[model samples]
Target chain A: MTYRDAINAALAEELERDERVFLLGEDVGLFGGAMAVTKGLYERFGERRVQDMPISESAIVGGTLGAVLTGLRPVAEIMFIDFVGVCMDQIVNQIAKVRYMLGGQVEVPLVIRTQGGGGKSYAAQHSQSLEAWFMHTPGLKVVIPSTPADAKGLLKSAIRDNNPVLFIEHKLLYNEKGEVPEGEHLVPLGQARVVREGSGLTIATYSRMVGLVQQAAEGLAAEGTEVEIVDLRTLTPLDEETMFASVRKTGRFLAVEEGHLTAGVGAELVARVTKNCFDYLDGPPERVAAQDRPIPCAPALEKATLPQVEDILTAARALVG
Target chain B: MPDMTVPPLPPETMRALLQGMMRVRAFEEAVHDLYQRKLLPGMSPHLSAGQEAVAAGVCLQLRPDDYMVTTHRGHGHSLLKGMDAQRMMAELCSKETGYCHGRGGTMHIASPEVGCLGANGIVGAGLPIAVGAGLSIQYRGTDQVCVAFFGDGASNQGTFHESVNLATARKLPVVFVCENNIYALSTNFARTGATPNVVDRARGYDIPGVTVDGMAVEGVYAATTTALERARSGQGPTLIEAKTYRYYGHGASDHRPYRTKEEEAQWRCSDAIQCYGDLLIERGVATAAERDDLSARAAAEAQAAVDFAVSSPDPDPARVGDYVFA
Candidate 1:
């Protein structure tokens, strides 16, 4: 099924399963969500739960926090994650701090579902892999799902998770088709997966970059080098066990992130692995990431600035060969 | 204004009101003392020393099920809303025994059990939060009404307008109590609002707004009871402004330049805790000795809270990720 259809199925199934789950955001109601992820929810659920809110990010995020506190799982669509900056206080200050500050008295079981990544030609304002920004915050669960199955599974898990989860989907990968389970299934947080196993080297990635890693792995395998690709599905509850396990087995590591390299998710993974599995490394942990700058508008410049499949192949080759 | 019909309250209710005001006053005084000794870390404690009556008045009238979302100057509201003094003190001291377990410090304290959503540090922030609660009530088809407590400065925030207008339009079961303490942080109400009274601005939203003598517990209780009744009946929201004051600076850091000491001393004479106790005495609801006993009891309880907080254990660091996920 198409990734968009899977997301729609997840929302529909969850809505039917739990009365506490509701949807709100800009153009979420009658407009069917900006990304068409919530296509026909309004016709079924009506306007009460599938609420259309004013373009006030503060009110939307703050209201979501309040709703969850009062016993509801609210999935708010921000249209794009880059716009989340406007509601930083609501996200980092309120949502992230609620459980900790309240001494575990309350849990904001809320999900902010937004699409992000630089390949859409949506330019600087719309395109950005700011998962690193959310990943930096300990309380928040940052999920970037690349495939149709993961998009649905991750979102379902996010809705059920008590912490405030920032569920990011790649804008360009919406139409991509992949096999997904017909019924309900959940992928647990703080876990990583070996999407493609190989002994030559390990290519660690997530979200859109997982697909690039697959392409890079396939390209390198033809060159008589085997590349293992690992997908870090959930960034915050980072599965260090699986990461270190794979790295130790392969003894070579390459972290590829679509985000800027400066203090990116790559840096976090590098730091964590260094502390946990330093002895297992064959070479210094290599990061194939976007240039440390805001994404530019031109197509060629954008391609050059982002973490491409060739970059991952080059890093993978350097480590194993 | 006397046309306001009086509902007969329980005989013990007056005593309860006096007890609540005294408790808040004693509790705030302890917080002030604790601040002076540097016992509190990362706290901007906004004492409701003189403004104790508003919280006592409105919260005493509410059932334990009714919710309250308050502002930075929220210690009085929290205590009056039934938060244990010990937990509030622990919260102020940033201990694990606190309502927020050392993480919230003061601004972000919440007790879901008592229905005290929190005492927010940001101005005008609690209105939308309360509005969201009101929406939950309506969605669940319950009669629960949420009370949003804010100061005069918060009335000018964008949230105040958006929330009030939305609450009125939807006829949500919520009460907006604007404690018009004459100042916002240190800025006077007249400096920001052009409306003769902040309550008058609510007329534009088509909800009833009333300005009351905030120092009198009975007056505020009487006014809040009517508004709350109207809310529960789905008559819509009410914005009540209690003209009150704090005897101290906005945070603990103000150097007393914004207003004259005479103004502070003037408000101190009509202290809600003292005046309410006197009212109960004159009405024969309580004896002078009983009032003194009650005040002493409150003081003792506030001190006991400090002791409890000091004795509470530090949270285990491993559980830092506990509540972060369900």
Candidate 2:
């Protein structure tokens, strides 16, 4: 199944399982989503369950929060991650702080699904990986799935989570295909998977960057340099055990991410590796990430702005050296 | 006797309305005294002293299962919705016995049992959430309605328009009540708003808009009842703007620098509680002795709540990290 198809299946199954679960977004119903990930959901679930919302981002998020408070599990889509800026108050202040502020009198069972990352040449506003913003927040759970299997499993788990979750999908990985388990395939949050194993170095990455790192690992293997790749599916409930264990075994760490280099998830990974496994490391950790600049629409400029396979190979080789 | 152009409500209903306004006045006066004495910590109390009738009128019409969301100046709304005055005072005092266990403090008290979604600190933030509550009621096919109480200031916020648009588009069962107390903090509503009245903006959405005399509890109550009936029957949302005034400054610290003493005196002459008391007596609903007795009881009730808040325990410092999730 394609990653898009896997997400679609997860939504379909969850909507069927829970009577309270509903989906609302811009163009999600009739247009089948801008990415076409929600194709045929409106017909299957009807207008009540699958609502088409106006371009009011604040109402979309705040309204979803109100629904969850009064007993309803709603999945709201922001169309693109860039559009999140329009309703940051709803997401940060209202949704994230409501439960804690209310002293746990209520649980915010909400999921905000949006597509992000650089690669589509969609320009500065449309193409950006902003997971680090949500990861910094205390109450939110951040999940980004790379594979079709992980996408399906993790999404189901996110839907059932009581706390509010920001489920980020990559524009580049929607068509990526893989084998998805048939029934009840659930990947618990805060668990990391070792996609590829090696002894010399460990590469920490997530979402679309995992593919780039894997391709880099293959190229490095031909040159007799072994690299282990850890795909961190969930960012907020970070599986430090898996990361620390891998870093301790390899004695080296390199983080590859599509977000900007400054204060990115890569920076957090490096700090954590240094703090926890300083004695186990042979040298300081390294990172390969997007350039600290607005992503231009030109294909070549966009490629140069983002972390590519070559960038990962260079960063990995230096870390392994 | 005063001119009785309209028939008076039953004596029992009239007494309830008068007492409701008196309770709000007493409770807010206690909050003011607590702040002055430095007993209440955290935020400076934004007392809804003079605007009691709006809360009493609108909230009295709501059932326990019906949802309501209010503004920063929301002690009146919380109390009218059946939240304990003692616990609310404790919350203002940041005690463990508070509604939010001292976590939410003055601006974020919420009781699910009473159907209060929350007391939002952000201006105009409650409207969209009210839209959501309406959506939940509609989605569940329940007869419940959600009322969103905001200020004339909040009507200028983008959420006000967006929320109203969505609610009307979906024909969600929500009532948008605007308490036009003429001020958004120190700035007068006229200085900030393009329109003279908040109800004028409702026409842009093509929904029914009603303006009521907020100083008169009966006016607010009648308008709210009509709105509630319209919402409960699935005719979509209605915007009710209650024209009123605030007796005190924006916050406790704010003195009367913006408005004139003449203006203050004019509003105080038409004080909601005092006027309602006279109206009750003139209409033969209650005697002067009975009205005085009600006022005294409200004062005693507010004093008892203050005592409860003062004696309540402070939250344990060790549990500060709790409630960040679940």
Candidate 3:
């Protein structure tokens, strides 16, 4: 199934399983979603279950928090991840802190589905990775799945989670096809899967970066450098055990991410490896992330800015040496 | 508008309304005294001392299961909506026995049992959350309505406009209650608002907008009931602008540098609790003795709450990480 189809299936399955689960966003229903991730959901669920909201991001997020507080598990879409700036207060202040500050009196069982990453030359605002923003928040869980199967499984888990989750999908990965489990596929959050296990060096990444790293790892393997690829699916509860164990074995670490290198998720990963596996490290950890600038609309500039297959190969070759 | 005749209500309800105002007034007075003594920590509590009638009048129309979201000055609404005064005071004291286990202070108290979603620290933030609750009710096919209580200052917030437009567009069952305390923090509504009334803005959303004498509990009660009926019957949201005033400064320790003492005194002439108490006696709902006895009881309750807070243990330092997740 395609990544988009997998998400639609997960939504359909969750809606079928739980009566409380519903979908709402700016073009989710009738429009079949902006990316068509929620295609055919409106027809199956009807208007009551599949709500199409106005272009009010504050209402979309804050309203979802309120609904979850009152026993509804709503999957709200923000159309684009960049649009989150419009409703940062509702997302960061209200939804993120409501559960913790309210003394755990209620659970915000909701998911904010938004797409990030800069492959389509969508320009500065539309092509940004903001998973680190949600990871910084205390009460929120951030989920970013790379493959179609992981996408379906993680989305299911996210919707069923008792806490607020920011399920980020890559706009470029919508059509990436993989064999999604036909039914009852559940990938737990906070678990990093080893995509390519090797003995030489560890390259940890997530989302679309995981695929790019895998391709780079195949090339590195041809050069007699065995690079292990760890896909950090859930960023917040960050599976430190898998990362540290991989680093401890390899004695060399390189963090790859599509987000900006400054204060990015890669920055945090590198910091963690340096602190936890300092004595085990053969050399200092390296990070290959997007340049600290806005993603440009030009194809050549965008590719140069973001981490690429060749960039990963160079970073891995240097780390292995 | 109908004549300002007092609607005949059950004697018990009349007495409850009177007692509710008294409780809110006395509770805020106690909180004010605590601030004066430097017993409270963090930001000074935003007391809803003079605006008790608006809370008493509007909340009386809600069921225990109906949801409500209030603003920074939300003590009155939370108390009237069934939050225990002792726990509320304990929360203000940052004690473990508080409603939020001492995490949420005066500005952030919440109780799901009483259907109060929360009291937000941000201006106009509760509007959209309340609309979400209304949407929940619609999806669940329940008759419940949500009351979103914000101040006049929040009327200009983007959330206020977005929430109202969305609520009316969805025809969600919500009552947008604006406590027109004439000021948002220190700025007067006259300077901040486009019109003298916050309800006039509702016309833009095409919802029924009504203004009531927030100083008079009966008038507020009547206006709220009509709005509640309209909401529960699927007629959609109503904007209620309660022209009220806050007796104290925006927060504790804020002197009246923004307004004149004469202006403050003029507005306090019709104190909600005092006027409602006198009206109860005149209508034969309660005697002067009964009113005095209720006031005494309210004072005792406030005193008891303070005592409870003072005696309650502070939250455990070790469990600081607790309650961050489910």
lDDT of 2 by residue, A254-291 (tens): 99999999999999999999999999999999999999
Tell me the tens digit of each residue's lDDT in model 3 across A20-124: 999999999999999998989999999988999999999989999889989999999999999999999999999989887888888889999999998999999
lDDT value for candidate 1?
0.84
Report the Cα interface RMSD of each model, rounded to 1 decimal.
Answer: 1.7, 0.7, 0.8
Model 1 chain A worst lDDT window (10 residues): A54-63
Higher-ranked by lDDT: 2 or 3: 2
Superposed on the true interface residues, model 3 gives a C-alpha RMSD in angstroms of: 0.8
Regions more than 4 Å wrong, model 3? B1-6
Candidate 3 chain A least-lDDT 10 residues? A99-108
List TM-scores for all candidates, in order. Answer: 0.92, 0.98, 0.99
Candidate closest to the true structure, highest lDDT: 2
Cα lDDT for residue A203, candidate 3: 92
Q: Comparing to the true complex, what docking class would candidate 1 get?
A: acceptable
Question: Native contacts recovered by candidate 3, as a share?
Answer: 0.82
The residue-by-residue lDDT of candidate 1 on A238-313, one tens digit each, is: 8788888888887878888999999988988888777777898878888989998788899998898898888887
Which residue pairs show backbone clashes in model 1?
Answer: none
Candidate 2 yields a Cα-based lDDT of: 0.92
Candidate 1's C-alpha runs over 4 A off are A317-321, B1-12, B192-197, B200-206, B278-287, B310-324
